[model samples]
Target: MKSPKASSVTIALILLLITGWLLWSSAAAAEETPYIRGAALIDTHGCLACHSGNLMGAMKVPPLRGCELPEEEFQAWVLYGCPQAQPGRAQQSRFGMPAYEGHLDPEDVQDILAWSQIAGHEVPDQAALSDLARGEQVALKAGCFDCHGPLGQGGIKNTGSFTGAIPGFSGEQFKHLCDDGDPAAIEEWIRHGTSERFLSGEPLAGLGRSFMSSQLTKMPAYQDILSDEEIELLVRYCLHINSLGPMSAERYEAHRAALASSKMEVTGQEDSLAGPSLPREVAELFSSKCIRCHGPKKQKSDYRMDTAAAAFQSGDIADFLEVSVIQPGAPRESLLYQFVSATEEDSLNEVFPMPPSEDERLSPEELKVIRDWIASGAPWSDKQTLQSAYSD
Candidate 1:
């Protein structure tokens, strides 16, 4: 028989092995949480405060929800800066959230997206199952592709020539877009349906040629074609496919710092505030939809919708800002407008069309008010009218 000390040592070794095995098993299970789970973890981390799930960005924070980007491209986005996020400036690290590098593992990032389909949310398992294709077919049937490109990639650049609309995605890609959740912008696109939509803040309009305002002719209402849920799911898929680039931690930090400096710089130099000319109805609209993102200087999205004048020239408005799946003027029609206008119960998109998948869209009266404003050419009323209308 073995000595008592040897027996004790052997027993200890067996217990240690068991403990190690259990830990390894647990880690494996955690790692396998999948894309949706990983995304949920991110949600739990409070990323939604700044980064939306719908990929529709706000003034301060851009969208990140169902962004459709490849892993390599997405990795770069997470790590570097480009026109998609910003040029020269770093990734945004100052937007009410923490840097995810130390807090999340790369595998965890993958899992967040994998588990994204829970709660019956749409998550396409195959690339062939693209809602963009379906949307493209609809766009073609609607004569949207005549200028917008084969996929809704063509858009108008600032120089007055037509260019490609923003890219589209396979079904799986839509998930990332919804995760960012900039539904207000989405609603604006749907309601206003104009080339001047996103122009108030962006500069890309400078590179384009012809605009597509004439294409705003009536077509089959989306309500007649796709279910609201189907349309929203498509939107989410597009964002996920488009946002497949990596996020750069270093660039994000740099941009965060720059944003801080830009704020300081603007504050010290500005003493000559412009005289107010905003109307009451428009003013109320601004207060409700424009202020949260654009009120402060160094406005988010590089565009400020706060003042009609400031936003009027911003290229992204006309070119396309975050919001509707379709860029306003091109082959891309504002689905936001289409879904919000629906009067039937089945009209509700996968989620409500505004605020977010997590939030409610405007009431019918409010939507009708906005729709009327857009239909009447969306003139910028003066401050007096705006104040009088919204004061109650």
Candidate 2:
């Protein structure tokens, strides 16, 4: 009805209004997304308890303050502990991280992802500044500091029934003893736990065994818990620490003196033995592997072996020792021997065998040593004799 130019201008104005409306709608939707909501959810869940500086247990809790990961990957990790993005690696949390699959909706996960991305962007890249900074973060997040020290120097862990003196990562002797700048070896140790040999085929021998044994808490096989990428980061951090050279002698000696003073408080001074002295090797084996769960802090099934007195005094352990002994010289009759010696094929119905977890079982050679010791009458050794032998 109107002129063509007037009608054309009206139509153009309507189209412009529609475009503006669409833009407004898109912005509003983005603003309303769950990521904003995730910020509140993080606080409500008390996630900072373990992930923050206020750690709950002896286990290391990886920090999430500046955590960076792909959006999909981050969402998956938040919803389901660990993602199976990679093969040959099982997903598990040795240091408890509860999954919030059903409890949190898709919207919740998205919100959390949003918050993490925002927070991550906020954190400055300190690792870029210095190797020490990177190493410190890795150590703290991986829990090295929990066992080592605040400075990655030596420290002692004295948990009621167990006493372990952790060596400094910076020590030249420790660096040489562990590995020779091989990241793969370091990575292997991180994933599968450290052994008496480095990835470069170096023998830990006497010093390695002593150092490994000094760790009061068993080093967990992190392959199940950490991603391969995370493990690589840790290796880089450790290598950097090693390059820094040994801890100051003064600090190391001070730490040792402090440990000596506190040793009695951690491991009760009960030194009574009922049988012949056990060999030093056998005692060291017990201290490193057996004492963690069976000793003072936690005694599963009322069995303990922290002290010679505890080993002989505990009725259950004493009975097991007696029943397992065959004619005072046969190790095969011993239930303790049988449990440690059982192969996967033979242990179908057995109550989860000794060292409970499959990853932490004693090696074949270690098992043989235990078997040999049991066969040799399972003699009880005094602490002083054992200590003197260790010093030699």
- What TM-score do all the candidates reach, one by one? 0.21, 0.27
Candidate 2: which stretches are off by over 4 Å? 1-135, 158-164, 199-215, 247-392
Top candidate (TM-score): 2
RMSD (Å) per prediction: 25.6, 24.3
**Each model's backbone clash number:** 136, 3
| Candidate 2 TM-score versus the reference | 0.27
173-201, model 1: which lDDT tens digit per residue? 11222223344433333333332334443
Task: For model 1, state the Cα shift of residue 1 in Å.
Answer: 99
lDDT of 2 by residue, 28-117 (tens): 221122223555688888777777866565756677654566556665666666753322242446327656666676677656654554
Q: Tell me model 2's lDDT, rounded to 2 decimals.
A: 0.54
Candidate 1 at residue 275, lDDT?
A: 24
lDDT of 2 at 356: 69
